[model samples]
Target: MSKTINIGLVPFSCVKLAEADFKDRAAVYVVLCMKDNNEWTVLDAGQSCEVNASADAHPRNAMWKTHCPAGNIWIGTYPMPTAGYSKADRFAMERKLRRQYKPPCGKR
Candidate 1:
């Protein structure tokens, strides 16, 4: 007999980077993910509303194809960093999450 490990519920958060009142806000944003019950490692990270907007086609979605009954995984964004944050900050956060999660899909 074979045992199956359900991916469990997908977890993610969304942040609206664009603000009509604040022109400085990021039009595109950042996203984070990690496997449930695992150490807090970012399973995947993405920046840019264009990429994020295509949530359904994300590569991470493939990871859950077999593991998750729903054939989907969490792919959401964190609140945009405050005014002090910059594009570099978003990259840095992606790097930090990649370091913590060591997610296979992250850039080398």
Candidate 2:
């Protein structure tokens, strides 16, 4: 069966990938909880679940395991990272954000 785990301390977090295997280089995802506001369910991939093992020809769309031995989990989502071409270009988006928002220098 599949397994899952809870990340410690971090309220809500994520790693946005503009280029992924499923989308046309325009997707955003959060692999961890950083806000602790929106609730999420058990992840389908991790150290406990062997989702990656099923990646053999027409495999499941998601990964379920990590290279590490810890009890971490993995998941994927669609329709995120904003909804524009700038969002797809991470560097350009960040630059635009900074220029438009103009946050305090040295911290973004």
Candidate 3:
């Protein structure tokens, strides 16, 4: 079973799952990298209407890989269906998480 983590008080699906699980989902995503010491670092956070597409086209993907050459990168996602959360709501959540985590990449 996939573990869950809290990001800014919200529960998110664990990282390292198949990307197909998140395809076409509207959600907020947290990019993380696990180091050799088993410490996890927050790399970036963002919200997307289509999580898979957003991830595929992410501008910082290269940077993320550079930070974790061992390929320990993971993505945790909190689904926010369009019917339940407005785009503004998702953006607000993303901003809140970014502020709390202060991820190394993106507009931190």
Candidate 4:
């Protein structure tokens, strides 16, 4: 079973990523939530808009033991190379961030 973590307050800009106004075709995003000591930590991360379309996409409900509402979730969107960005590049970047942050909700 995946570990459950608290998704607390985050920046307003981060919350906007999940919104239609902020969603972009070429982007990578990381979902962040508050961890202990009041520090924001990565809860999950991904690089595709298609995968993010589902209700369980952000925190991946199947992996987590608890549920986090939309208000508790924040996304940090990274603009990708529009001209030549490839799937491999996106995957690599996601792996890099996952390695660094070790977000509990992300794939192992």
Cα-based lDDT for every prediction: 0.41, 0.29, 0.78, 0.55
The better-scoring model by lDDT among 1 and 2 is 1
TM-score of 1: 0.49
Q: What is the lDDT of residue 58 in candidate 1?
A: 52
Best by lDDT: 3
1-108: candidate 1 lDDT, tens digit per residue: 111122223223432212112222332222223245532323456454234344555555565344444322443444354565676766666666566556656474
TM-score of each: 0.49, 0.23, 0.82, 0.60
Per-residue lDDT tens digits for candidate 3, residues 1-108, read 466877677887865622525679788888888678757787888888878745644799888887767877778889899999988998999889888888878883
**Which ranking of candidates, highest lDDT first?**
3, 4, 1, 2
lDDT of 4 by residue, 2-69 (tens): 22233222122344324424534666667665444545667776777443344334347444324243
lDDT measured at residue 60 in model 2 versus the true structure, 0 to 100? 26
lDDT per residue as tens, model 2, 55-96: 222132223223212323333432323444344354443344
Q: Return the TM-score for candidate 2, rounded to 2 decimals.
A: 0.23
What clash count goes with each model?
2, 10, 0, 0
Winner by TM-score: 3
Q: How well does model 2 score by local distance difference test?
A: 0.29
Model 3 poorest ten-residue lDDT run: 14-23
Misplaced by over 4 Å in model 2 are: 1-21, 33-69, 80-85, 88-108
